[model samples]
Target: MIAAGTASMGRAATPGPSRWPRAIVRLRLALRSSEAAARGGGGGRWAACFRPAPVAGAAAAAVKEAKGERSAEVEVEPARGGGEDVWSARADAEVAQGGGFPEHLVVMVNGLVGSADDWKFAAEQFVRRMPDKVIVHRSQCNSATQTFDGVDLMGERLANEVLSVVKQRSGVKKISFVAHSLGGLVARYAIGRLYEPNNRRASSAGKSRDDVEHLEGLIAGLEPMNFITFASPHLGSSGNKQARFLLLFYEHMTFKSLPFLCGLPFLERRASETAHLIVGRTGKHLFLTDNDDGRRPLLLRMVDDSGDLQFRSALRSFKRRVAYANANFDHMVGWRTSSIRRQHELPKHRLLVRDEKYPHIVYVEKEVTNNRDTEARADLYDPEEEMIRGLTQVPWERVDVSFQKSTQRLVAHNTIQVKSYWLNSDGADVINHMMDHFIV
Candidate 1:
């Protein structure tokens, strides 16, 4: 094992602005966590580090050479988010020609440490079924946002890109969204902020006609008729009491936890209350309130005990005040503060609901819905090879829970399992369900 002292520090060749270090650190920690989980314990604690595949890039080169045409039917474009201002850049005609981007416009957002390649199979399905639609990747994964200007903050930047993509696509009346993990937050922030009159007051405050037109264009862009997220922490969950407990431990233990959240483009993504009010089962916001002040003791103890990260400590204090004293939310995000329309029952239109009745309520209806049953497996994906291919077209097309009619009702957190099953299985039913909604 390498000594902690042996670690060397040099500036990142390209340090992103917010949570730049946090993303890198989280990326490392996630790798370590994956390894630790994989090891299942031996005499030594081996950290599983799934460094990016070296051979994959080489293989891409080899395929390029063999094809001889030097062109690919499927173009793997870089994701754009956290601000490099590339989202507005139009898809090239070659990439736009014929079958490419032929259907209704689909804007895909990825989870943390994920990339466009992540959407590979789903994109292929969309391309085959609805060949005219353009599915643009939200590039937040590419910059990792630590040093980049626009990429910082979870949902804000992501929302902007989504708007831009929808507006740019010709004849696009309806827009669809598919996001995973924190990527959902990014989309949420964008969608929420776009409609906020407070956020759009600048338009009426004396601007040029051209500026006003651009503003209107941005605001009135394509309508978000359908939305889907994969295992997103929308109602932010750790899946179990153990995960919930560990999140508490991490908040008090790790310095890197809190600020990492605010870096996303999510609207109003303040750090302080994430763990306590959003994800915590007992916080004021969640359905489970057995421990109303559960997180308080942990935060106080962390500050009193051994040194904790300053940013984290500050967040603990901030979140405590905002959440405990005011809003009362947590890590998994609260339905009251999520990208959903709150209701006594699931909304008949938007499929992604802020569930109140079931465990892991976000899961899709498991039983087949009058369609041919072709998939038998729950999941066949290599989760390790994922994360890098952000808005992957991977067959992980989940069920289109965005049913026009709401006969099925899902518990809030149950979505995790539903999403997991689709992403893991890459089933045709899942793809077809999404397509059904998109075309409809």
Candidate 2:
């Protein structure tokens, strides 16, 4: 049944190449025009390139067939007040059935150069699967060239965007974040700024330990649930090394991968140095080259709570924290960085087996806590090692994904998140695995 379902999904999801070329051409033209407008100091022109369209619901179609009925129609609340474009996925069936709207808010964030449209498919899947359980909001505050701003500034915008959403959704009592790639880092920073201690719990002392724990902190004044990231560079991307030229050459020879990273070590070194010029401050942050105010890189400082930002504390408050990493063929992010592990800690090849239910998920590691003493500071120079040490202070569930055998392997970074249904439909299994294991 699982195998059949997989095949059916793949067939339904992958769009024919001949059918999408025109759309691609139009999109490219729109982006070029938007780029020109951006250069002319009009940032808002980029919005036209990402107008919300009906999400291609390949996974939702299968879900509807299984349930013997259509899921609730999703409603979109477009961008307003010059804020982020929000794809609000509300289940319409609940309203028809006289049910109150869902109180759990799921915020979906896009990666660098991406818009809220990037998360449309996943947002639709989430709403369709559990129409009454969640309200998925795809955030668009820092899309396009705006992502060129440093992580700190992007994070501030995200935090404010979230707050505005919460204000509008008065019934939402719980919150979760699902972010992709560089957006994961932005979400992490935003969470720190959004965290507020639950002072009401202090006044009520008779609560059980579990109750007290659950009420320990609030993110944007709502209980924090799951914090999940796909192919996120948690440990930064600079120092982490891949197999180099052999893999780079192989990817170029066979599949289309990111052009910025297709050379030898010297090129890799050069890319690290000049990344900021291409992608702006985000590139610096990803490469761990950002040093604002002569302090350590923002990622290193984020490992521990520095002053009011409570980065680590906000992270620990979540009920579950998950990092989904691509095991290979993800030229954009290295496995060591995404999974937040040391060089030797990566899973051995022998352990990677395809689960019948989740074909692409190769290995799952239970939460592991760092045993390093809290008093000890990480090595100052080795930021990657320092980040690993700092982030592992709290336990994290690591999920390793591999598209090595699939045609989509070359774009494993985007495939891991199923960024586009037509191009990365094979990753539907990965998205299914995430939703099936998602903590409500």
Candidate 3:
């Protein structure tokens, strides 16, 4: 998932396509190999690779390895019984989900730098709120895949996974989504490639845009209902926090893309123009130090050049495909990029239902009464002050189910585990709303 990083939306020539392509290829390869090493017994040196794009059923395919040393062929047990090679084809098990769900099949996509396990708590809440409905999880590339290019295989993979999930779920005829951060971008790219129309007949020479798009459309015909993105930076940054060098490169480079990035096409000059349009007040968060045994750098600050326009381009390509939206805050993504700008085209959609605020859990953590006073504080808030006194309070932001679509943004950067007593909390409520939209 794209959080705070630097990628602009404009197009620029990669300088004669000479050394740049080779360099990109080399960089991409190194990123892939190093990331794999980092993931596989390397002691977690890098952040987890971005989640793989979606697939329908068969394990999604990758761009044929540049190195003859191919990746281990991935095999997936399709929920559906079909044995087709196409990733989007449904399996028998997935078809079963169509039975009689109280809610629709809402596939949950987790945030950047996380996995399906990350949404386990939220899924539990959904199940509790409406047990009769089917709640699905989109297994991203991060769950099993380990490569910088895993995203290269995601869009088609996800396109099919949605079909299989709904087909096997018994009563579900269509699928909906609840996504966070880069997961949303991945989903959009997958959906667009799968659903976008292209009738022109192109040669099998190379992976041309129209050709790639057509292939994507063939898979995306499996349209699901109401796509949602949480705290996803759809608009890219305006370059407020970045130092001068990166901004300068962004202006001159018009960087349409990086070889490592998956999906969206990176145009150079267009990217520069887009960077100039940001509203630039990103959220602030307590840096998550020790998040990965101290190997992970603290990423609490949101400076300029901290976002990519590739995701924004991907989102823009199929903005129409998304029906509703939500956001989580202080987690990494900013509020400005997650908006719909109150779409002038779609009367039925206002883009997002944004609920920005402090999460209640951080305030109500277990308190220490006899601490020797280790850390310093600028000014303590309610829950922090309460914690110092060994007291707790109900986290208020934990009150809402995360997927509510009534507003344009949701600002809870801190998420608390909701009690799952057969679905009584906000997670459950959000799931219920999804059910009403899809399964009903």
Candidate 4:
């Protein structure tokens, strides 16, 4: 029951040229030729080369040949006639229907050091529970490669990846994003890029305005559906007193090798550099500590009025936006940061009650204590303080879930998408609750 286009849970292929069969290569050439012909006034020459007149006995063989030697893991729709790719035709039909696209496209983004495989379990569950038409694509951003790069760079890459996905799945008019941890930030950054307004109204002679308009139309046409994050540090970890030490400890534990002075010497060096950058400028943005320039914190810039208006508009466009916070045993992102609320604002009491509406899930919601009501202490001027004020103004739902002590000990930050946890009763409940947000 794995969703369509879900990447294999094994290692990702190293970035390189894809080895293709002779027939497949020819097929691509034919497609390209057809596309070029379409752009010109001439009719498709390669179309006839690939697809000959249908003869009774040979038609079946032609169909088989067209199927090619594709792997079972990959789903490939047969090329339909009329010199147009099936996806393009489907997209055109969808546009004609005026209902936007009938199919739901869900993109699952993994956190730091996580590959597309991290979402395999969740994708399977989503496919099994959701409608058959839903297609889930697990995004591979800073997974196989270096994740130490800045969030902005990752965000730009993600934006390009998403655009590529959109182009490939032309019929996908609506999209829902499910991101984990740092992936949430990447997703946010991508959406911001997609929603950036065309400030330069007048297009240059070389760059036609129509091109810009078309690109803008394509982005706007993709109706953003649900946006859900698991254990994302929305409010950031910088403000959390415990986060600094935890991050350092986690880094040490991850990279420390007995043979080397600090573990793998090269890895340790990279980790040290990452830690410095993360705790300094990057950490400041994530934690809303220091505004590097006059600009506010990264999160505030993502959704504030003065920041990117189009980004804020795109965020508001989502039908449902939810952040699921781990109440216990999450060392990476704290519950307060995940919930985008202040640390002291959470309810002191821990009440575990099964939701009547969602029987499988147990959750707790705490009323937000407005920090703005309190007088601002006279302190050094920090632009982050202003950003935090703006962030608190924007209201969002936060659900708290706590796991059993044993589960907490075994499965902390990784509990969100791990297959074993999803199989467990409590984990199933959590998954059910998460899926509910995507419904409709």
**Local accuracy of candidate 3 as per-residue lDDT tens digits, 68-167:** 2223331123245221111112222334666333335556664433455445444533444344444455455433222112232444566566656545
What TM-score does candidate 3 get on C-alpha atoms?
0.37
* Prediction 4 TM-score vs. true: 0.61
Maximum-TM-score candidate: 2
Model 4 misplaced regions, further than 4 Å: 1-102, 196-220, 242-274, 277-300, 305-309, 350-374, 380-388, 392-394, 419-426
Cα lDDT tens digits, model 1, 59-92, are 4542232223223444444433232111211234
What local lDDT score does residue 92 receive in model 4, on the 0 to 100 scale?
39
RMSD (Cα, Å) of model 3: 20.3
| Candidate 4 lDDT over residue span 96-188, tens digit each | 777454367777887765666566556655654553446677776566333445466777777777777766667666677888877887787
Clashing pairs in 2: none
Candidate 3 regions exceeding 4 Å error are: 1-103, 144-152, 163-171, 196-223, 237-331, 342-439
Pairs with backbone N, CA or C atoms under 3 Å apart (clashes), candidate 4: 257-263
TM-score ranking from best candidate downward: 2, 4, 1, 3
Arranged by lDDT with the best first, the candidates are: 2, 4, 1, 3
State the C-alpha lDDT per candidate: 0.33, 0.72, 0.33, 0.52
1 versus 4: better TM-score goes to: 4
- The candidate, 2 or 3, that scores higher on TM-score is 2
Cα lDDT tens digits for candidate 2, 1-440: 32343244245334676654453445444445545553664535433432222334575564442223434365566643233322224545556678777878899888766778677667777776777788887888988667768789999999998988888876777899999988899999999999876664333333454765656587887878899999888887677653131122222222323222233465466656666655567667777778889988888899989888989889988888999999998876789888998878899999999888898999998878876743445545566777888888888999999988875575677778777654466677898988998888
